[model samples]
Target: MLFRVDVAAAEPLADQIAAQVRGGILRGDLAPGERLPAARELADVLDVNLHTVLRAYAKLRDEELIELRRGRGAVIRADADAARLRLVELARQFVGEARRQGLADAEMLAIVREAQP
Candidate 1:
């Protein structure tokens, strides 16, 4: 009943929230047809405004990652494709940020290799 997420990139908070929920669906952390918390509850859990959470949910609905049902909150879709796209985008962003931070190719590669898969 708890949801926590880190804010990252230049993406809006709503988009960040949507991306995380999309990823969770793809990774099976949030199973298909599972019930999502109410926007208010999620907002409280994430310490974001209700409007922010609703925006995320709306975005997810548009992406087909979740569907709004009467009195049932949002439900996960059977499949969500947004995850792969988000991962790729995030990787590119990370690479760009690392380069901007003056991390050399060797250093980046070392860090990647050292990271646990």
Candidate 2:
């Protein structure tokens, strides 16, 4: 899988890396049992610290989207569901936008209700 990061962006490098991996999974570009590039290798390519890549991998692990195995590196989980992951990604974006707009919980819920057919 290919990954990119913007050092100048407000988002942390690790978060950026994680997002890219997540996108790849959601797009079917990265399939189950596929091994990701080693953290050291990816860090060298991205010009970031090794720990940064590790942090990203850890985040993916926490989300159960990837599995980190000794001597095998990181691999996409066999049970990772693209559709469910996509919904989670969309919900996160929606909530972030709502927070930025200063909308209250009730207002957000109302909007979601209206959005439902």
Candidate 3:
């Protein structure tokens, strides 16, 4: 999966890296059991600190989306559910956009209800 980060963006570089990986998983570009690039290598390619890539991998590990093993590096979990993860990511984006639009919880709920068929 291709990773890109915007230094000028408000979000941290690590979060950006994590998000791209999540997107890759969700889109089936990264498959189960597939090993991700080494953090140090990715750091050099992305021109970010090794800690940044490590932090991103750590986040994915914490979320149970990837496994970090000694010498194995980071591997996409065999049981990772892309569909569920996609739904969760979508929900987060929806909520963030709604809040940016000055929407309240009730309004967001109502909008979702209206969207349901």
Best by TM-score: 2
Question: Order of candidates by TM-score, top first?
Answer: 2, 3, 1
Error of 2 at 5 (Å): 0.8
**Clash counts for the predictions, in order:** 0, 0, 0
Which parts of model 3 have CA positions greater than 4 angstroms off? 103-117
- Checking candidate 1 for backbone clashes, the offending pairs are none
Q: What lDDT is obtained when candidate 2 is compared to the true structure? A: 0.95
Query: Model 1: residues >4 Å from true position, as ranges?
Result: 7-9, 79-117
lDDT per prediction?
0.79, 0.95, 0.96
lDDT of 2 by residue, 1-117 (tens): 678799999999999999999999999999999999999999998999999999999999999999999999999999989999999999989999999999999999999999998
Off by over 4 Å in 2: none
